[model samples]
Target: MLGALNMGAFFALVYVAAQLLRTSVAATIMAVSPVAMMLIAWPLLAERPKPLPLAGAGLGLVGVVLLVASGSGGVNPLGVAASAAAMGLSAFGHVLTKRWGATAHVLSVTSWQLVAGGLVLLVAAVLVEGAPPRVGLPAVLGFGYVSVVATALAFSVWFTGLRHLDAGTVGLLGLLNPVTGVLLGTAVAGEVLTGRQLVGLALVLAGVLLGQPALTRRWAARRAARVAEVSPGSADHPGSSTVDSRVPVE
Candidate 1:
């Protein structure tokens, strides 16, 4: 279950997001994942939210509404449900990883989850889809790329990043994954980026940026400064970058 949630979330979300919202819009939606993680962790892990991250989450909500409402198309129920499921599962998986392997090596965690998830998925596929897929060169290439680059390298880099930076910082950086997807879809798939989509995408990015540690700190410091200013005799503390953001589990 955990493994399925971890690996399957990425594949399922990407496909559905691309189909429902186009590649770029889908990527923008994914940029809001950190916000989702924070929310999920709140109820599950007793986490709290920082002001900037909350603002970013709000921005994500707006962006989602605008993007879905743009043009003749409103929100597609199936698409929204699939995307939400993908994100929710991803968030749950992350929390479980943190809880299950608080002291375990990231590689070990990755390996165990991948194996369990693969087996579960394979069994599910055999039961529902009814047959193994024909292995072709293109399929092989796709599998190789996802396994080597997306899975292995991504987790390695992520675990390393967790060592140095805060979760908000690392999470913000992870948004680059969706950005690459959006760009590639535009260049390779010839997907059109409409005016409304551009605007919605902008909102999504702005939200993600707001949720980053640096920006969140900037906002926090500014608020603190303002509070100090308004008060008669308060200590001045500039460059205090602590927000109420949740720390990543090791």
Candidate 2:
């Protein structure tokens, strides 16, 4: 079920989104996934995002819109709806993983989910797309990279994140996926990165950083320490007050 929703449905709807909408528009709509994940997590995981992170998620959305709009592409209403559906399905899958796999080992959970999704994709490919025309060296290497590094290792970390962090926080990190994708396209796929894309990337980074609890805590602690040092109120010590709010207590 997790695979069906997250892997299978996610990919399937992506195809649907592509067919219904322009590629850029599809990507833009899919970019709303973090917000979708947040909404899904609210009831599924009983998770509520902080105010700043919520705003950050909204900012990320704005970035995605800019990124897509900056590109030259046609748009469609149905495509927008399809992309939204894909985003919702993706978010739903993430929430389910966090909820149902709460106690499961990350490797085990990710493995099973990927297997299920792979099986479904395999069946779909055989039925609809037919056999591969050719498995050339580049195609084989690409497949291996996506299957191993992208799916196995990457999703392992993602599943681990779902286990440890609130869904909203982890979901916000997903915005980085597009940043990586866009940068990769520019670096390897011969795609151009427009000013809008750069702005979008910046917004996404700012949003994701804001959504990090550990980072926020450290900032707060540092701010408190600065205040203590400047205010001259030695609440914990004779000369100065030390407030350690960093995660891991390091």
What would the per-residue lDDT of candidate 1 be over residues 212-241, giving only the tens digit for each residue? 777777887999988887564533334444
Model 1 stretches astray by more than 4 angstroms: 8-32, 43-47, 60-80, 159-178, 189-192, 228-250
Error of 1 at 230 (Å): 5.0
lDDT winner? 2
How large is the C-alpha RMSD of every model relative to the true structure? 10.2, 8.4
lDDT of 2 by residue, 1-250 (tens): 8898888877887787778776667766777777788887888777765676788789887776766665465677777776787788778888898888988888999999899998998899899988869788999999999889987999899989888888888888877767787888899989998887889889988888888988767877888888776674665555655564663554
TM-scores for every candidate against the unseen true structure: 0.69, 0.78
Q: Count of backbone clashes for each model?
A: 0, 0
Let me know the TM-score candidate 1 reaches against the reference structure.
Answer: 0.69
As for candidate 2, its clashing pairs are none
lDDT score, residue 248, model 1?
Answer: 69
lDDT of prediction 1: 0.65
